[model samples]
Target: MKKLGLILSFAAALLFIACKTNPFTGKQTLALVSNSQIFPMSFQQYNQFLSENKVVKGTAEADMVKRVGQRIAIAAEKYLNANGYQGYLEGYQWDYNLVQDDQVNAWCMPGGKIVVYTGLLPVAQTEAGIAAVMGHEVAHALANHGQQRMSAGMLQQIGAVAGNVIIDDPRTLNAFNQAYGIGTTVGVMLPFSRGHETEADQIGLYLMAIAGYNPDEAANLWLRMKANSGGQEPPEFLSTHPATDSRIANIRKMAPAAKAEAAKFGVTSFK
Candidate 1:
């Protein structure tokens, strides 16, 4: 039994080593879950969410969500194709909906399912603002941030398992599991979320530009976001997004470059 356990551990370690590559950053990442498995589960959950939620019908806001989502999706495709990632979206089933919620939040699930809450409409005061939010959400999907997060969790789990193997005392193992689980959730996951937020910001800038929305508006939109939220947020270390000041500064720095990128696709301004 011990020999079999040793063989299993060795195989698991080998699998971990084989799956290490950051899809967006192009750095070595520790990923134990494969997208082939993750995508199906995400799609299932997204469909369930749609079924459970009150999806807004043919309203102007809903229409706008679909239109903007399509444009951003196209922009992602064009960008990826131009960069030699021709079939990057092959398995993606893109769907966008406006949910009649008062929460100032929006998110894109893996495999391109998106939901925008009605409460955000005021903050997204214009078509450009909607594009900004949608682009940012879609960027999270395109960048596979969800997958990376799940992968990171799996790595943390593997670490916990290794710790259990090393520690013989049952009490020690239980304590280690509890501590590791909490640490992974609060420490590793929170930072991973912040990284996702930053990546989405960068990619969203370029996507909105390519979709012909003014990249400059992104900063203003975030400013509005800050105002709408009443400036309430956790400390920078605990939050999943950068503080408003940092976000505004980063967006300002990236806007010009995003505009330049849009120009490459012959998009100077929106219709």
Candidate 2:
């Protein structure tokens, strides 16, 4: 009971004190781990990854990756400033790199380190398509999804610890472990990840539009992505992303609104 009490108190304290406001949504999100701690680690890991990988440089495709990433970063700043959240990105050291990898993936780590795999470029097809993909990845960083995920992971660990402390019977504890693992992952973690993906999709559309890329192309990009997958995907609830069809439909529906938001920034034309 005493150990359980301590665990509960620690978690409650984290819940109360470890939160940061999401600039785009104005919602308080988990931040049990601060950016000051996460950024340096992420930066180090990014540098290490670059050293081990074949980083593409001096090519038009590499140039386009850097170009689109810079525009999206600028768009993020513009939105933040216009919304009275000036200096929200103070610690971010934005870096974008193209890597010679065959995997179709792109990601932005905490503090704005971005990498676009070569395999993604063929699917991206155009500058706007790259913008769409980069915009979404950047949104994940902007919204501090990494920080939130770490915090949630810590909470899950705490839950497991608490269970171990409270349950003494071996067989009963085994059952508890199984149930807790499945319950927390499928019920909580998966949905949490999907929600982050959806939020990134919305925020990315707005940022791409403000960067003078056609928001409509985001949906088209996803269509290409879907085709590239040969139509094989896990069920939506079991996956970290929305179903491709659902994502395409959502992007199509949000494009008009994204364009309207971009108009506020004098970006009336999109390429």
Query: What lDDT does candidate 2 reach at residue 269?
Result: 95
**Candidate 1 lDDT score relative to the true structure:** 0.83
lDDT of 1 by residue, 1-271 (tens): 5754775677578566746443345666545566677789988998898889899989999999899999999999888887777887888899999998999888988788899999999888988998999999988877777777776766676677677767889998999899988888778788788877888898999899999999889899999989888998889887877888899999999999899989999998763
Q: Candidate 2, which segments miss by more than 4 Å at Cα?
A: none
Q: How many clashes in each candidate?
A: 0, 0
TM-scores of the models, in the given order?
0.88, 0.98
| Tens digit of per-residue lDDT, candidate 2, span 68-175 | 999999999999999999998989999999999999999999999999999999999999999999999999999999999999999999999999999999999999
Model 1: weakest 10-residue lDDT segment is 18-27
Error of 1 at 220 (Å): 1.2
